[model samples]
Target chain A: MKQDPDKSRMNFPNRALKWLVILMVVFLVIEIPLLISHARHAYFKIDGWFAFYAILGFLACPALTFLARGLGVLVRRDESTFGNEDDKTLPEDLDEQLR
Target chain B: MNNFADFPPALILLLGALLVPFLKPSWRSVYVILLPLATLFYVLQLKTGTGSQFNLFTFTEEPLEFLRVDKLSKAFGIIFSLNAVAAFIYAFYYKKSTQHVAALFYIGGAIGTVFAGDLLTMYVFWESMAVSSTFVILARNTEQAKGAAFRYIMIHLVGGLLLLAGVILTIARQDGSIAFNGFDFETANHAGTWLILIGILVNCGAPPLSSWLPDSYPAASVTGGLILSAYTTKTAVYTLLRGYPGWEPLIWIGCAMAVYGVIYALMESDIRRILAYAIINQVGFMVCAAGVGTHDAISGATAAAFCHILYKSLLWMTTGVVLYRLGKSNLCDLGGLHRTMPVTTVFFIIGCLSMALPGTCGFTSKNIIIHAIEHEHLFWPWLLLEISAVGIFLAVAIRLPYFLFFGKDKGLTPQDAPSAMLGGMALLGFFCLFFGFAPGTLYDLLPHEIDYHPYSIAKVTIVLQWILATGITFIFLKKWLTPKPGISLDFDWFYRKGAVQFYRAADTTLNGANALAKRTFIDGFVKWTCNFFESGASRSTAWLMTPIWMLQGHNAEEIDSLQQSIFKRSKRGAFQIGITAFCAVILLGLLSIIFLLE
Candidate 1:
């Protein structure tokens, strides 16, 4: 069997990368509130900075999730990624010219 | 206002694109050529120096504004139309009519962009270009093209969405309607500005979000690759000049793209991809010029943009011609073609000069930008540009020809390029020479005064020395730079592999608990409801049916049977006891609910 890199198990280096992504997300989330505070100080002291921090906090989890996915060295097991592969749907007669 | 002014020529060409696909085979080629030509003449007519604005009702409540004909816009519109004609001529017999139609619409959308007087109109044309151009990539008819087109569309649509947000926010923060000539950035820090910046940067191939381009562009069909090279990013450079010039961050971003693209191009073996990365590097020069924002800087930026489209398209067209004739585009699979494909080789050499070879179109225009940076004393951008100059020689200028044509002969012979391809190349090659020799013509067209000359002895000497030193480096290290079989990963690894693992890990941690809890909770509730209904129905039926059975059996002879039934009641007492027990259990449940209510 060809050892597909996408499906291969993570070696130590791969594991380390996932951990790094997690840590970065954590660090970003923790500093976000403080960063918002600092930005307000530099400009005008505005209340919306708090809402901004909250919004970032809400987004951080998903961002980290996708970031980790982007860093992974495994192939997706799900078949849905290729869409409908069974039909071999060439573009009908119109499809001939497009192809 | 005249109807000529009301319908911009680009829009008319765009509307005409739909009909191109339906035309007869004989008419297709002529239609493709004439539409852009007529459209070009129409845009030339708009040169009377008039601007119009209109609001449109689609994504927003206000009518979308369209601005027409100005100096800054005319430069881009005229050249874009010219590139369309050249591309159509090159693609005449190569790609299908469908792709030709798509390319026309794509070019039209790009032309619409330069004439747009407002941000909203620019964005509409911006997205229209994105959607239309994507079909060019998808025309390759490979599984890879499907994924590539998807990613390509994803990035541009994201750019479009951000642009919409930026335009809206900027309008809300301002007191007057948009005038699209040049940006006045003091008022641009509105919500729309960030949206707009992100939108434009996405198209400009800025980092962290830049992988979609290299990931997809090389996968396009041969003729498709030539069409793919021109509009998208340059439109972004145009938009940036209109909306966000002088933002200091753009300087660093431009420098980053220049170096990053050069490094990646050095690692790629695919010729089209190398050319694609070269596009990023060349755009970097203009972007940095935009960052400087002086009259000289803007002129340099504008000139660099003009030269870039011609040279970049030339390079892609050269490669596309070679691939079309030879049937392969990867450098590893190509070699010794200079013997047979002399026309392509000659054109490729001329195209290389325009990419910053001394005394070519690039040297004339690029020196002004590099000099503008030096005159401004921006040390970092200047140093990076110098390093990138060396890197460009290794990555593209020398590397492209060396591996593709002069490499260890790969035992393949391809015929000479077709006349259409040759004609396209000859036009670009001629311009490369003409512009290099007489740069004043290009310089005079710029929006600012031309005070700088690129042919001065000292500057030419410096550039020549850099090229010499780099060529010497290449001669010594040529063995190390040879193409090898390997695929290096880029930032896209996060989405390709990283995202899957992240999802799997989350599923792994929760799957067992989620399944167990759900099964137990649902199954137990279902069993309890089934048993309660079964016992209650049995008890209720027995109580109602017993008396009815006795009455129905009570005929004259049934009287005797009824008396016997009365006598049998004592024996049936045990059966009644069982029925009574069931009824008591059901009544107790009802009484408990009643008691709680009370």
Candidate 2:
């Protein structure tokens, strides 16, 4: 059966999962050395903002979650815009009501 | 050393490239090719010395500084200009006047960036590249091109804003002299620093915000992807070298980008996306090298950056040629074309080798970086880089060509690529092999001495063994590692999915707000006033206004009358009116109260 182009492209969720993993790695990687570097540079009077940035970096996860939920609603536009006749494109194996 | 004031005017001539839009299309191509050549010759003429600078133009309130021409900037400038020349030659046959104009300005911006003596100038040129390069992407005239280019521009523009803010803060704090200096990072105002890093990272394809490259590059026309791949990331590496060389977090960030890109490239079916991931991986090595920040490490970083510009561009060009001829770029849709396109096959194989295949340019340069890690004994980055090696082998060395040209045939019989495209690939491939055979020119371009030898017997043997082991491992585990169907995810999903989700959620919330704004405002005020008058009004008033009471009322007038009666009886509205009356009484009574209290 030919795959629906819309469903094929909706490979959107898969990319989201991958991005989540990559970002998790990026966040941790960027932080570890920053913390260590901050620890090493103790003699130099550390500004309060580095600590603030560190906190913000850690907080980006929750922020990203809220942001993601927000964006999902925008990307998933209403399905009916394409057309009204669902029966035309329905597969042979499918029940008519499922369409 | 030439006098600081007597330096070359090459950038000025190139900067006039703002005029290409006014020229004819035929004239545009010549202008594009000639402008970079002109800029290159002029950059070559700059006098070498400390404190050598040129005042180019003035911004709205600042001097547009250029011609700094330090050793660090010189290497980058030369490489950037060389990239422009090669990219132009490859793009010479491209008929789009906008691409030519955009390419020229993009090159100008890169040159202006490298030579700029101050932060403001760097930023001005930085933004120019953003605008011009975006047009280059849009010139592809496809829906994907339009979308990807828009995302690309938006990311860079955000970066530019951050960089501009950083520059403004740095200058303001330092009393307006735009001399470059290392930040204290702790005591220094880091708002600017973080903004700058973000700005640069967006270009560098850092994680969490790095989806632009893989999302966009594959969607470009053949030659367009080649030029696209070269500039943005390398400019970012250049920015880090100039601004924040030894920031240790970058080492780990670079290592992650390296490994992360390789993982995604494994799942990518598009040839250009694979190459785009490879670009991230290559830049990861350099970023890690720069993070290490030793003189030798920096040299390795410089050499890696230089070689990457050569080899990665070559790889993309090869992939571009394949895509151009076949009319499709999906790995699953490609195979068995080596029979017809032998020259392209050779060029592609060489490009794969240069992707760190043994005895290729990637071998020499990547080894130098790994050796620096060994020298420093940085175990974690070293280990991740080593593991990443296997992933790279799987993605580029085995999977890329294997699926595209040697796997089960997709029955595609597209003719051999146009000679022009093949010529470009051959030229780039020749450079890869030539540089691999002789690493001297690359070595000479490094800012520091090359005490570490890349071609030693022990190093070569070790590199060869590793490559051989990876190759063998890939063959045995090819099924597990190489899936024919399915695209893997990367950092870009944030922009792709996260951005969409956030926008949707925001859209819904905003829509809800728009729908309920007046109700919320009125209800909030009424509720606050009801609270304010609680002493005067009985609790029954509050209960009656509740929805249950309103439902019990059964008629609209009854609920409205009940609410209006409550408002009339409540003292809350009269409090404001009576306050002024009380204040007047207080003034009249103050004299008596003072006398009475006394």
Candidate 3:
């Protein structure tokens, strides 16, 4: 069976994801030791630990995203929340006005 | 200073603006492109430590410096002019002369503010910026644009007033000296300094006022937004760097703005608004650096601001092209545009220059701030800033491009941006790479000499790991992360909805009260007076006439005719003249009193 070029192209995202994970693993292998061996000083001890920045980066995204999602429940409004009936692009009373 | 060197670069652009309206279209394009270049040349020629001074009315002791040439101002001056050239190139396809003029004045105002040596001079150019930039927003001429422009100007006017008050109070305290310089916390405790800081903070998009930026910038015209992205907040950062370095509170405030911008950006569906919020995020870094107040930190802030103007403007221009072609800026309405707008995607992805990605301008510039934080051992802020750095990549670098160009196809096939816009983007994109690889070119322009490295193995490795991790997290959460069509409220909610509702409520109540008052007091009084005159006069006349008629043994008709004849005979006589003169004297006396009070 021949593969469709479009179908192959569509698979790029999935393949790209797998490759990304592999790349991350390889980066961790190299980075973990470098972080441990690196001469670091800090105002706080925990920040100087190996993988501290890496862990922060990994956690910050989901934490901030979820927090923002929670905030959205409070702050989110309709698309036209700032606008009013007068701000409508199309007049609602067009028929009446025309008549 | 020689006359040529003393000639203000800002005036050159402003004077050139007056010529734009009268020129032929071809000449107008050439003129716009050349004006900024000419101003840049003049600015470059300005000698170090030399400035133009003006003594207003010969009463003040210190002459106001209209043109100040120093490492800091020159750095900002160069970038601002370069930004103008790129912005005008992108705007070449736009035909409206008024927009071009407004843009010119806005750029001129920014340059003026950069070069101003005194608070008074800064305030004048500050107001010019507020007024001209409002026109840039208003130039869009949409109803939404109109509303946003009004809000934008109102916020800036308040900021400008605060700044003016601060200037006056500071000068008063300083024996009438209006020099613009840095102040420590002790000096900052003064009402004037705090007011000045707040004023500058408002422009920095700090905290509550931060929403004004995301609210207004996205509402500008395609070209207008790009122009706006370059100058306003960056200029504020420059002012903060000039006047309030080492203020510790800005660190927390700036971090709040950073996180605040990211969270809102994540919640936003509109691509332009996302970019707007990202501006607040990026400027947050600069503000935090300024607050850190180290030599390295200030240099970092300057370099970051310089690079930020380019990359942020590039992002805006790319999104602007999308809005111009598709008539939509919402992420939900955009996807898989990379196939059609490959050039824009290529340029837009260059916004990673602002993401501190390796081999980009952001890496070299933003790292300096991080290095300063580490050097200063501000552990908590360092952690927060580092996290926000990742959030920047997630919000702008990864999510923005993925949804805008690579995600689910929206079945819309808009063509690439026009050649002029592409040309502008390409120029900025090249500089992003050029400055990334050769950061010394930027570092050489800094106000201080410092040694910094961005390409170390540990740094590069950590950055890569973080970015890769962020990417993985994004992929896992892709489905959940897709933007839905809605608005995420920000501090703008207070003014946009709360203030407007308050105004409406007040208007209704006041109008109703006015109507009630008119009915109860005014109408009643008028009715009573009319009735009293009509009935009382008639009754009194009848009573007198009846007695007169009975006493004189004459008819009422005869008495009435005799009265009418007497009134007609006295019409032009001394009695009428005397009464008119008396009334005129009283009216003149009242008018004099009113004029005297005024």
Candidate 4:
């Protein structure tokens, strides 16, 4: 049997991940020097202090994720909770409508 | 003078919509596409001044100017027409003729609202929009669509009534002119202007009622969602820009909506609902800009609204494609779609232009709003905007596609979207980059002249770094960030459940009381009266028959039959008399009470 060509080809996501890391490194490297030299028209000088947006961006995601999780608990319901009596249980003809 | 200039562009679309149902099936598609184009050509040919006029009624002395072609109206008119073209193209394959008719009337109403020269004209078109858009929702014909459409129209009906009340009050207070122009909140001495503002805010997806956007939009048909996304809130934004700019309270309200939208979107499982919340978040930015009311702020707000219409609709269309092919839009059910549907994935990535990435349409427009905020030095609002920006990236731009295309590979294989859809997406995709690479084309269409540059080394670098950092955060937290399958509650819960419960309780209590009254008073009284009449009649008959027997002049059988028939007639008459007396007594009581109260 011939060698599997699929195995020989590099996985697309893996290669993309590798390039993404490289791009991130390049961006961070460029960002650091620019942060040192940039003069921002900020209301407070501290707003322009090194890598402020980067830190804000870095922390906001996880903080929001957890907050959303907390919110999800208070607000979460079964998907069937919305709509009227007909929607609570899928209709017999729903599959036909979808097609 | 009823010259050619007297013809309103909206009339073109409206008249064409009336003709759609009569056309042959093959001709219907051609008719739909040509209508908007014809309206667009008419819009372009019009001059920059009020022309069309009609005598609305005797209530107002001066005739209403139905077409107002100022720079502001013109800008919105152009975008609304273009969006109609894109929407019709995307929905080219839809077989429901009713949907096309509703969409056309909806578009006409929006265009009319923008071009309206007086408050009366605006109110007329606003209600038209409400009715037509409800039909679009109802066209889906699902049970969910029916219920959601009812709720949606009920809310809009309230909004419309508020608008009408405001217009009437304002005209009564202000010399009966009914002019549509900016109101000075600083010197606003009348309640009419306030009522108008509240009405406009209702449509803007402002707080307390903002939940309607997410509650109803996802319940629409795939094509319906795309059309719905473009018109309603943006027209409200246009109205705000026209009438309530520089009102400081709007700035805070807008900021609240921006953050509130992203927080809820993060917890949503359905892809369409997430996008619905995103519309509110994006409109919040424009609302804030309108509140700022500076030259640059207004320009930025308008530009952002225009850009938003394109990108948001593109996002809706992409999700719609998924919904059409895979039969579901919940994140839990979709995975590894990119392997089979590469073109759709690429189109979706293009649709992420609203994330404000560099070299996308969003960068060119959204930065101006931030710049305006910074220039104004509104520290708290600016900081909140920055935080929300990252939230948008985390919740929508990064989260949506990652869950749909990447991760766990749920082994679903669906075909790519049809070429017609791809063609429609390609048209919008072209503009996203077209405006991105060259901002001048978009800038030239603005209501004001401005000198604002969107791309600079510092700005580009800052944006890139922030996105990358957000990316890194997601990478580390991806497992925990996977969307769970559930529904999130919203303000609509108060109306959807609380109000519904209150109505239920009230209905049960009143109905039970009604039944009790009928059983105890009406039925019992009728029964007792009948028994009393029967017993008295029998006793009298026995007494009379004893005397008649003594006379011995009549046959006993004949006498007995006559007596029985008389007794039966008397019983029937007694019931009728009792019912009549009861009704008459109640009516007299009610009349006496009214007289006493008066």
Best by TM-score: 4
Over all chains combined, what TM-score does candidate 1 have?
Answer: 0.76
What candidate 4 gets wrong by more than 4 Å, as runs, is A1-33, A83-98, B1-6, B533-598
TM-score of chain A of 3: 0.51
Best by DockQ: 4
Query: Over the stretch A1-86, how does candidate 4's per-residue lDDT look in tens digits?
Result: 88577865757678778867875676668576576666444565656766677787877888878888888889989866654434
> Which segments of candidate 3 are over 4 A away from where they belong?
A1-24, A32-43, A84-99, B1-5, B537-598
- What is the DockQ score of candidate 2, to 2 decimals? 0.02
Ranking by TM-score: 4, 3, 1, 2
Report the C-alpha lDDT of model 3 over B210-294, residue by residue, as the tens digit.
8888888888888888999889999999999999889998889888888888888888889889988888998999999989988
lDDT preference between candidates 1 and 3, better one: 3
Q: Please provide, for model 2 over B1-598, each residue's C-alpha lDDT reduced to its tens digit, 9 standing for 90 to 100.
A: 2335644333543566668678777777666766666666766665455334444444323444566766677777776776676766666566566666676677677767777767877787889888988887777676667777888888777878888887877777767667654555456636777677778888888887777888777766667778888888887888777777677888999998887777667656668777888888878888888788777777787777877888788777777666666556777678877877777777888878886755677777777887787777787887677666656765787778887777677676666666656666776777788778888877776777778766654455444544554554455455644434444544555776678789999999998898687577667877777776664363465465668756676477776676665666564545356866888899889988999999
For B43-158, candidate 4 gives per-residue lDDT tens digits of 87777866787785877866787898887788888888988888787777775588889999999999999999889999899899999999988887788888889989999889
lDDT of 4 at B542: 57
Rank by lDDT (best first): 3, 4, 1, 2
What are the DockQ scores of the candidates, in order? Answer: 0.02, 0.02, 0.26, 0.35
lDDT of 1 at B11: 70
Please give me the DockQ of candidate 1 compared with the native complex: 0.02
Worst 10 residues of 2 chain B by lDDT: B1-10
Q: How does model 4 score on DockQ?
A: 0.35
